[model samples]
Target: CHYCTFVTVPGKLRRAGHGMFLSPDEVLAIAREGAAMGCKEALFTLGDRPEDRWPEAREWLEAEGYDDTLAYVRAMAIRVLEETGLLPHLNPGVMTWTDLQRLKPVAPSMGMMLETTATRLWSEPGGPHHGSPDKEPAVRLRVLEDAGRSNVPFTTGILIGIGESYEERADSLFELRKTARAYHGIQEVIVQNFRAKPDTAMRGMPDAELEELAAAIAVARHILGPSARI
Candidate 1:
């Protein structure tokens, strides 16, 4: 439904609501609605920022007294899922070792896909999220190493087309592969196409073509080796 909401024709059915940002009761209600439709596994993606793409939406929630931090979001997710007996049906993204430890027991083996948006998007010298790749790599390695200590399986992916070059894409894959080699936990790679959403700096920019995405995936598979999945 989330997919259809965005990609549908004429934008006839938009996913506009405060429910997506706040209101645990509303979120739980939607989860129940999904379950009733035979969705055995409910997958809810909690965005890293409330308004990283839609600042107005995020601000609205803040005005209404919503906690926008990842920690609060995770706690709310766990709360609603448990309250409605949907805990077994939930899967949340863990960004760091601390988050992994916190959510693993609640949603064991849940995906902890390492986020790399800043790595690529911020590569430009003046990019808003800019940080050195040199520093980025160590953070990634620590995430992988900590995932190993937890004795749990996981999956990871990358956000592409953030004004990064093809070489940078390949380099990102190489770094991910290096981490996977040491941890042996990362099992899948999702190469996400960046969307130029409203209220974001990248709005109106073209999204990546299918061929570019395929090529990147192919290169990623090669870099990750035959044993590792991409």
Candidate 2:
């Protein structure tokens, strides 16, 4: 069984409605409901360090009595584990060594999409990750390394149809495999195809064809070897 959780706050908190943010009590209640429904894992999906991006985000965290988003998440994870019996899996995006160390004990596992290893897209006008500071490929790789150093079970993968060449997709998978082999922390690799959404930067972009997706998955399997889970 699977369940999910989101901080619900956008990077710019002012851009979101008041109802978007969920209180700690609300999170616990949802966890209890998930436990009753036989859900065994909870995924914490939220903005990556929104407090650093917007003043309103910082204000909200302060108002909630949390010094930072990671602290708040750690507390929620512990609460969910103690009260609801669901293992917490976090997707907090790019993190530092300290962040990984702090989260490792509370979250049994964690993840972040490698998306792509291509840095060229970041410079393209109106590219999917153009303005996102945390989307830097090198930064994301560092997070993976730090997670490995912390001995955390990790999940990571490449994103297709994001203006990356087939070669770049293979590069991303190879990079992930190298890190996984070195650290032994990567437990799963996901091959995700990008779907353009409305009112976003890549809305007009085309989705990956089935053939392309299959090829990418094959590359992942080949690079990650038989011992890896895909």
Candidate 3:
């Protein structure tokens, strides 16, 4: 997303494709160490589908005998579970029913940030989500429903700031509540505030104030209720 400041290798570095992923053995070794350090859950928060964006990602996957990043993640999740005895919580972005089903056996939970349901941010030019296809509200809501249908414990939430109005924030929480009420698979909802970074596309955007976060959290509580973990 345009507002994101997460460390990622895009464009030139992605095209260069010089780096390689650690082998499964190496990943398991780290997980095992984490388990020794009393970490019971191995959280995997990955960038969405880099292979779809860069051919280098595809080439790297092919070199490793995987067709896509999701399959690689599933395989790694299985390895983490079997070798390290750490429960895996995946956040591989928007996923389909089949993808959820495939990852469910190894992953106890998964998450994807809903951000907001405002189509304006996604459809209008110069908006935070305009060029980001995975940030599409319909697609994200579909993922939520699919996770519910699959009986997977899921985490999701609305992001405050980023130019969405209070109404859009409320609507996003309500959408989450609707899915939670239907399938009871939602484990938690996070109310996150945007913290723009100097290096990001949203560097000039104002940071979300405490008032906005408090308001959003209050509304989330009202919509999702006291029983809901927010």
Q: Which one wins on lDDT?
A: 3
For model 2, what is the error of residue 173's alpha carbon versus the real structure, in angstroms, after optimal superposition? Answer: 0.6
Poorly placed runs, candidate 3 (over 4 Å): 10-22
Cα displacement (Å) at residue 207, model 2: 1.0
> How accurate locally is residue 165 in candidate 2, as Cα lDDT from 0 to 100?
84
lDDT by residue (tens digit), candidate 1, 100-158: 77666655445544435345344555553454332254465566667766755666676
lDDT of 2 by residue, 73-110 (tens): 99999999998899999987888899988888999999
Tell me the spans in candidate 1 whose CA falls farther than 4 Å from its real position.
1-21, 47-96, 112-125, 131-141, 226-229
- Per-residue lDDT, model 3, residue 10, is 50
Candidate with more favorable, higher TM-score: 2 or 3 = 3
Q: Which candidate is the best by TM-score?
A: 3
- Residue pairs with colliding backbones in model 2 are none
Ranking of all predicted structures according to lDDT, beginning with the best and ending with the worst: 3, 2, 1
**Runs with alpha carbons beyond 4 Å of true place in candidate 2:** 1-20
lDDT against the true structure, per candidate, is 0.58, 0.82, 0.88
Q: What TM-score, over all chains together, does every model reach?
A: 0.65, 0.91, 0.93
